[model samples]
Target chain A: MNVPRHWREQIRRYRLVGSKCTDCGRLSFPNRAVCPKCNSRNNENYQYAGRGKIISFTNINSPPKEHKYNLPYAVALIELMEGPVITAQITDARAEELEIGMEVEMVTRKIMEYNDDGIICYGYKFRPIVEYAHP
Target chain B: MKPNKSVGIIGYGAYVPKYRIQNTEIARVWGNDPNLVPIREKSVPGADEDSVTIAIEIARNAIIRAGINPSDLRAVWVGSESKPYAVKPTSTIVAEAIAATPFVNAADWEFACKAGSETIQACIAFVGSGMAKYALGIGVDTAQGAPSDALEYTAAAGGAGYIIGSAKESLAIIEASISYVTDTPDFWRRQHEHYPKHGNRFTGEPSYFKHVLSSSKALMEELGTKPEDYNYAIFHQPNRKFPLEVAKILGFPKEKILDGLVSPYIGNTYAGSALLGLAAVLDKAKEGDKIFCTSYGSGAGSDSFSLEVTDKLAERKGKAPSVKSYIERREEIDYAKYARYRKKIRA
Candidate 1:
């Protein structure tokens, strides 16, 4: 929650910017320096397309101390369009509305308030994608 | 102000918070008739959302609609009255979030409700002059209104963003633009003030009307086009009535104004009002359609632009969610939940 820690995780926090294995073409969130898929060190920076589908989900009715204020929130494992499955908070919908295979898109939002002085942290959250009929 | 080289909106996007606070709920808490409320419902940002977050979301969609890499964006400008931090620039956060940092010029702008349109002017200037190939301009706000105040009924959250580039690559071409300004002090929020204060009826005639009508008329005269020539006319909507009255005074038909009348659903998004209205109109406009947009800000000033839709508009319109969809996606919340979401109440 401090400035240094916040700065360090900014890539993953913003835009789901991560790493991709150049050799095997596997994507990794949190941006690993090494690719696990091909066991190759040949990795390149990649930005996820932010489109994905819910693979699984859970409701956090009882949250930890820091996240207690946001109780009853939903978290889900999302399979990105480019093929990386990552965990993220599901927003703009209730627990009952969530379903497996629901289309979702990444949205930037406040993650938490780090301290009383109001140093807030921001990150990505997923929301259901509303499809519009083309006119 | 017409740019030296032609510049237009290559792409555009909009974001409205899913959480809505209905007028009836606000009226219930204030012991007033819901029928008297200026807006039917207003958007409320979630605990995990703010002006910066909203800006980033819409900017990403704009980037997508532009069909360009985020790094191609050379400038990022955000206009808002409800920026997350007063001293810090919201533009940098937005640029970084959208992966446009390190190479882009970033800044924040404030001109009350007209701030967003001001960004549009700057972006057009930046791109038209070849200072940058692609510049992003956003008008977004998580507007604040004092508890139980009249402003609370109409002051709401939402915004829209546009990527400005050459007319050849544009979805809508900017034909002409003009601005009218004066030292009108109709609305203001002093330093450290939680909510803005207005000169009541003073915000009308001398402020919104004077600036919008003059600017719109000037742009039309310069373009040699009349209200009848435009397929759609969009004016900044502080309330449903203001834009309607302004449109009528300018000789634009009600049908021309209704397509862009979004404040009734999302409240006045301050800097985002006019831009969001433009987005709604663009969502439904076809190629060859002419549109007139004018924005009013308290200080006060108005920026008017004459735009012509391009064939590219039809192809790129589906690159991102339509403004109509964002409006349709909603979940109504009660006053207490609205208070909690907006952080008016501490947990």
Candidate 2:
């Protein structure tokens, strides 16, 4: 990706800023301009809580050209708490450790390097949420 | 220097990569004895992790612990030696990641290893002067060491962050601080140099020890306190031995430095070393306890602070995961896998 494209995706990439349909209460990632489900134009900017579960995942042993450095990485369909499903790369855990319905949280990470001397694109990734007990 | 408005750490956080490579693995790769390892294991950032990503994780934890709106942050400072880009400021990325943009002053700082502590000093000054209600200071790095070099054993990745504000809203109060710097070139990395070079034993006497000792003594003398007066003492740990030796020389018992001597497990986090140690100590310290912290950077210099735990510390302790939890939550990898994670070999 070039500089402009990286800049354009910054808000959704960093803050999990998406769109929630006011008419049907459906959440959509990438901050959709219109609701996909109900074909409603009534949508508000929504910020996801970033808590989600792994719906399905696949191990990318052979990655894309830009991401070839990270071999055998996992990409997953995450069902967010706000009722939107988004596809993202999973990190901080091995492929063997990932399972369906595992809880995860969003974290910012480098998505890919554009070239040897070009811009580096960064975006959100998911990590398993280890349990922390509070009294 | 004592802040006029009594500024202190309102909240703190730390982040170490989940991937760790055992010292034995490095020793095996370099054809050396595992017994000669300086640390047990060192954190390694994944292919997608860098200084900015690490800072964002720790900053998020600090924000959670501070229990304040991200927009409340008036400034954000990140100190590191291994920023992702040379010209662009890492602080801007961090500020935007934490959603503290548009009105906050943001910049990147470099002072070798002590840069993180420098961020703390700047934050204290900003809030103490009442120019900002809150400021975030982060010391983070994905430090680089040349392959098979001695620096490889201990130059690791990790960092800690602090949110500084009024003492009234703090879990711990900074009573005083002092800094000692000189034009010593004990360690340095030139422009475009991928890895840093050190002056062998030169980094020891005329740099690390001298600066750390001078700064710590000066802060203690100014505060009219003794080694025994502080409940805990945290010194920059380049290895397991440096902090212990410094503690003994300064008349502090080994037990006082135990909680903060974290380099043994995480390796030297460069700018993050001493500050991470202080965070670990704060994780277990009690109210009314005193802590003496001194950080050494290789250029070289030291920044020392004397802090006192407050009654509010207990309430804030559970706001985020403790330093111990981060350390305990690790998954070790072998040398080949480590090399891939660190990008030691080109894809």
Lowest-scoring 10 consecutive residues by lDDT in candidate 2 chain A? A126-135
* lDDT (10s digit) by residue, model 1, range B31-126: 998788888898888778889998987897798789988788899999999977878899999999888889999999999999999999999999
Question: What TM-score does structure 1 among the candidates reach?
Answer: 0.96
Model 1 local distance difference test score: 0.89
lDDT of each: 0.89, 0.90
Per-residue lDDT over B1-347 for candidate 2, one digit per residue giving the tens place of the 0 to 100 score: 98789989999988888778888899999999888888899888888899999999899989988899989999999999998899989999999988999899999999999999999999999999999999999999998989898889888898999999899999999998889999999989999988889899898878888999999999999989999999999999889998998899999999999999998888999989999999898888889999999999988899999999998888887877777777787888898887887777776
lDDT of 2: 0.90
Worst 10 residues of 2 chain B by lDDT: B338-347
Question: i-RMS, every candidate?
Answer: 1.6, 2.5
Model 2 alpha-carbon drift over 4 Å, by segment: A37-40, A133-135
- Docking class for model 2 is medium
- lDDT per residue for candidate 2 within A3-85, as digits (tens), equals 88789889789889999889999788978787999989999988898999999999988777988877768999999987889
Backbone clashes for every candidate come to: 0, 0
